[model samples]
Target: MPETPPMTPPMTPPMTPPWTPFALFGALAVLAWGAAALDAALAGGRWPGIVTGPLRGAARELVRQRRRTVMPDVPLVRAGVCALPAAAVLAAVVLPLGERPVADLSVGVVWFNAMEVCVWWALWLTGWGVNSLHPLIGGYRFVAQGLAYELPHMFALITAALGAGSLRVSEIAAAQRGLWFAVWMPVAFAVYLVSAVAMAFWGPMDRPVGSDIAGGVRAELSGPDRLVFEAGRYLLLAVAAAAAVPLFLGGGVGPALPPWLWTALKTVAVLAVLVWARHRLPGVRMDRFTRVSWLVLIPVSLLQLLVVGVVVL
Candidate 1:
């Protein structure tokens, strides 16, 4: 038939690979580590010069002013500022070292939670050390925000610990040999993700560093001090993503890959999500976050704990 058109080929949809959080973490870790190393090398060991140089100059100018300033006591502020980098180093060493079961401790869950608390305290100290009104306000805001997120986040971890019958992160990963906790406890995982973002001051929870209002607590920091704080932030992001993988997503459960590689993939995925979210959301007002945390996250976390108890029991 001259009029008959050739049969159109059926269009096939493009095959999309499943997206994983671990992949994002691995990529970000490499990027962050590389950048930090490069910055350290090029800047003559002044790694955080990228962020802190201006702040340091400003602080020096302020010191020369001879004018009175209303701020927290200087010594207290210095101590707090000093602690942030120390905490980051501790996390880098403690969280990712050793294989499963070898590094797994019965009290691992408690230790992880305690470290987060320490992070909160150190951030407050940094804010307080600025000894200026904006930093003080920013620091207090951080405290309030911490109150909103920390309890629910702790509860979510507890649920996982109870479900696996051990606080050890490696053991929790082992328990998910057949299935991931993400499949069974999606709600808890969701809550944990939200809390982690909030704790890290990313995305919708970044009011403490709100450029519009307080200009953030680190506004006055510079040189090595500033670099240390920024590095700590990146490391904190890395640690949180790493923890999420082992705790919730059946750490490194996969075919055709070693456990460590699998873990790396999962952590990378989580970090990417954090970075993506940081780019996507407008920060919530401080008051709005406080309300949401108290009214929504806390109750949900408690309910999740109850659900885990029933399932595990």
Candidate 2:
């Protein structure tokens, strides 16, 4: 018989990626509303009343006239207020939704860090743009807080990246399939939680918007402007909480339920804790908290990073 031609293997097609997170937008919106409702309930959970609280507040702010201050920088104020949610959304884009991110950049962890650092600028502008004594003071307070928290936050992130051996958020999530980062990196996890709340200026770290300064950085905002500002704040909180999942909580790793749903559940749980903190813990004065952040949190995070580095090596 005549020799036959050898068969060649067929080429496999490339994977079809989820480039746009259109559905993620909806998920984030629900999370934003849930965060608002959680804060309202924390303030006072009055059955059905808490459910409508955010809506009612939004309506009230929408109809009310905008508050203006002497020599205010309207453009700066608008940009500053808008930056909070924008930063949050951008940072979130690098995180995984069921093992794949919207962008999936190789340096996703770095991307997340850079985006959050913008919060420092956002609050600073919001505080200074108003050209009021209280607003200026509030801006100063946030800058001080940022100095205290940012170092430790960086160390904690570095620790996670070290353990995962990759800066990509998806790889970090994959690394935790067997065991979550939080299991071994307790210090980093704890520090992350503290910094998460601090960066958002939520709970104990909210002195920038505290009672002492008549709502502080937000003192001059009103009407639709104020509404957007409040929503941005909550969105930051929600995004921070959601990030905890992919970073350390075995994101979308649960059995039985769908991965997306698991991610959402974990996110909501963390968001509730952060919002509830406002009621459970008294707001820390910047003077005392700043010292703790620098002296205690920074050292602890460094130790965690060192430990993680050694283990990875």
Candidate 3:
């Protein structure tokens, strides 16, 4: 009788709820518009500018002509400009909306990093393809910047994954049910924020499109091409800001509000802080920033990672 015990059923993986692609893109569009409006308002020092500025600028760009450059690699420039937003969207796939991601990849943390690397490619191609000196310099600057920030950025990501002992973003978010990672892992959180800005080439990291270099990488862009590139930039920033929620801010874990609403609120808060930083922080030279990144940030992040590992053990 004991030997005839009924066989247990096979274990099935938990099912994830379905989410639509349109929802993902729609959220991104709204965030991008918000970022643009906020930046415009700050620049003008008038709160009223936030209402109509983004719409006015977008309409103008849509109808403007694509300004020609001498011996420009048109195809390459086109690819680069379009790829920026495409990369942003792809990266957002692994990021959970409320509690479910469009694609809940096992290695979501790694996936986000890989997609962000595409920004470097986009910048380089756009800079080089334009066949201009300042743009070329801007492209090279980003490469140097990448080398500087990417190491600490990766370590910060690894720390988050290590703390949860999972690469899946949702799992990581779940692990923080007790305490938000940003609260415990302050160093990693700070580094992540800094790298987020640098990756998007926003705020203090806008040397890639600095006014001194005549708009740098985007100097030659105009019309629809310019529109696409600018949209892509804002989109990248929005995605970066949103990813922080799952990574460090305890995604969708607030009280009272629905999970999705909590996610939206957190995202807006982060995006506002990032946009405000542009008006406050001074632009830094890539060389000096690189030195600080390697000498200071890298070591600090490594220490933070070590502390997290010990605590986990």
| Highest-scoring model, lDDT | 3
Better of 2 and 3 by TM-score: 3
Off by over 4 Å in 3: 1-19, 45-48
Q: Write the per-residue lDDT of candidate 1 for residues 209-281, one digit (tens) a residue.
A: 6786546766666555555566566667667777888888888778898876787778777776766676667
Of 1 and 3, the candidate ranking higher by TM-score: 3
lDDT of 3 by residue, 216-255 (tens): 9999999988889999999999999999999999999989
**TM-scores of all predicted structures:** 0.76, 0.92, 0.94
lDDT of each: 0.68, 0.86, 0.91
The per-residue C-alpha lDDT of model 2 at residue 239 equals: 83
Off by over 4 Å in 2: 1-20
Candidate 1 lDDT at 284 equals 84
Full ranking by lDDT? 3, 2, 1
Instruction: State how far residue 290 of model 3 sits from its true place (Å).
Output: 0.4
- Residues 1-313, model 2: lDDT tens digits: 5588667443332232654477566777789898888777777688778888888989999999988788899899889989988898898888777767788788889999899989888889999998998878988899888888889988888888889998888888888988999999999999999998888899888999898999999998899878888888887888899899999998899999988889889999998888888889988888887888888999889888888888888
Residue 87 accuracy (lDDT) in model 2: 92
Instruction: Answer with 2 or 3, whichever has the higher lDDT.
Output: 3
